[model samples]
Target: MDRAQEGGINDVGIGALFGLVDYRFEILAIMEHARHLEEDYGCGPHTVSFPRIEPAEGTPFSQRENIPHPVSDKDFMKIIAIIRIAMPYTGIIISTRERPELRDQLVRYGVSQISAASETNPGGYDEEGDNTKAKPYEKTGSTGAQFTLGDHRSLDEVISMMIDGGYIPSFCTGCYRKGRVGADFMDLAKPGLIKEYCKPNAMFTFREYLEDYASPETKEKGLRLLKELTQTFPKEELKRRVEGNLCKIGEGERDLYF
Candidate 1:
């Protein structure tokens, strides 16, 4: 981290693998680490992820019996809520390491970043699954996979779930592109102003995804989500900009953002 910052890589993420140590100790260490970075660089972590250990194909240690420090579901939720309160500005990531139900529950709670439809093993994406519609995807016994994923839903499936819950499934990368980093990012984030840029960007990206990739049902639900979001947007001028962007997107514009 020190070398990255000194070498001009200002934005970085910090996290602890939950099963590596006691969850209580790991959470504290994560907080302290964030504090350390903030004191030295005037910016804390860009994101914090707490992926619990999952079983891996050849690793005996990954088995429940061999695991050293396992975190229970209840405790994991507490960790998420605590991190949200402690450093509310930082991104909170929930990966596919968690079960689908838990991952769904998490996004509504405190998680701000998530991964879906991921293939961890080398060339894992190329393999065919036996049941594509399984509620929780089964690992296809792919060798070389570092760990098994608990959530096996496709990207569209994941996004559809989020939309069903009235959550905006965002694919925006505008802030980094706009050079919102370090102190600049913090200034907006701490004041909650970043939402003005982020929500609209999310709408833009969601719209783009619906137009290009979403299933017909997903597109309908996603469009409804867009309407709710636009109607509820707090700022008027920015809402107009968002409206314009959405219009342009309908006319084939791509990669628009705040």
Candidate 2:
């Protein structure tokens, strides 16, 4: 389990073998354990717990059971309630398997981040059209890789789509740097402690993309969006930081966020 967490496992981060099996009880235990860890040991920053909500094969969508499975609407609401009471600072990542309208509704109900154009397989990004190979590190006996549910897109495509959908495709990397991690970080984060760092970094990454990867039209659109967002905050200081970061990025800074 610790190995799984270190390897970037999440609710959606299933191994190839686990993906094929219907280990419903085991999955529930995992989710419950995560919840307990966050509540007792302060290990999670965002909502560390996830409900086992994926529907089983041959199950009718309308009659799906809640709890230890893809939660029913009522149970989902209950989960949110529990989260608010026990872990309000934690964020949820709603998978793409839900209906588009349902997914949108979840976003409104405090889902802080989402995956787009996600490929479960390690080389899936490079494979593009092929869908047969399992992700490099996925366990054996796993189901074959499955495509993302929404418009099949790459990260770039997803960013563009988010922009079109009137959302900021944030690449903020503040929490990791600020030493504000786990549930305790939430107390510091509640009043926007890290926004000071996050905003500048987000702008810096956005600016780098605008100047480098984006086409003139994309640059124009991104700039327009930036202008609108920046106007809401006094961002002169952030602008300076962004410029400095952009310079470092141009100088081949590797592993920087966008």
Candidate 3:
């Protein structure tokens, strides 16, 4: 994925490929696979996919063997190394299970995105911090209880913190909308077409955030940041597209990115 991004390919999204057993090994495999993708196929701007990793059914929380605990410093360093290698191009997104310390470490290592207040279950947010119903919905074929991290903050708090920390908490939803995926999309995206879609989408989402969620001070800061970013990129057509799309985002789509 790094190579693809470096080579100017922009459409690929790589999954984290996590599984049961050692998360250490899983992290290593993710790094290795990303490295291979960068070295060989030139996939760039990758997304680190998060699949639910849960203990087997009926296993009590205390006895759950495969659950991820806070990673040790050594393992954290390895994760950092992987992130640093991929940071030049790909976007790393860590899900909610990661401990606050680990999340801080990964942020230091250049993780670019995150999911805040995520629930695996449908309609889970309606309950809002209720752990019992936050479990994965049966319709989704998920069996384990839901998990929360980092004090189960509201979306506003998370985004506020993200902004204060100097990260772009993007709520982009372009890849699916743009019809850019699968094997065929990869070929056209090799020259950075995906970035064309993603950048504008990010800007629009940021704008929508300001319009809907920002406090006066946050809105001021966000606008300043947006102005600076626009200056850096300087693409009028893309700017226009972003403005147009911002209107399409429904009023109800509030807490998806946090």
Best by TM-score: 1
Worst 10 residues of 2 by lDDT: 11-20
Rate residue 30 of model 3 by lDDT.
71
lDDT (Cα, tens digit) per residue for candidate 2, span 1-258: 445445554212211112223445444544576565555544544543333334433344423343223435655555544444444445665555555555555555666566655555446654444544435445554433442244344445545655666666566665666555644465565555756656656766666666666666666777777667665566676565555565676586634642
TM-scores vs. true structure, each candidate: 0.92, 0.58, 0.60
Clashing pairs in 3: 4-42, 4-43, 5-44, 16-49
Please give the RMSD to the true structure for each candidate, in Å.
3.9, 7.2, 7.5
**Candidate 3 residue-wise lDDT at 45:** 32
Error of 1 at 135 (Å): 22
User: What TM value does model 1 have?
Assistant: 0.92
Model 1 off-target regions past 4 Å? Answer: 126-142
> Distance (Å) between predicted and true CA of 69, model 3?
9.0
Candidate 3: tens digits of C-alpha lDDT, residues 57-141: 4555523355455344466556656765644455666777665556656676767677676655446655346534544555656
Q: Write the per-residue lDDT of candidate 1 for residues 1-258, one digit (tens) a residue.
A: 767877898688999888878888988998998998888988889899988888888788889888798888999999999999999999999888889999999887799998988767665553354333233234554456678889989889999999988889899989889999887898888889898788889999999999999999999999988987888867798778888999899899999987
Residue 172, candidate 1: C-alpha displacement in angstroms: 0.5
Better structure of 1 and 3 per TM-score: 1
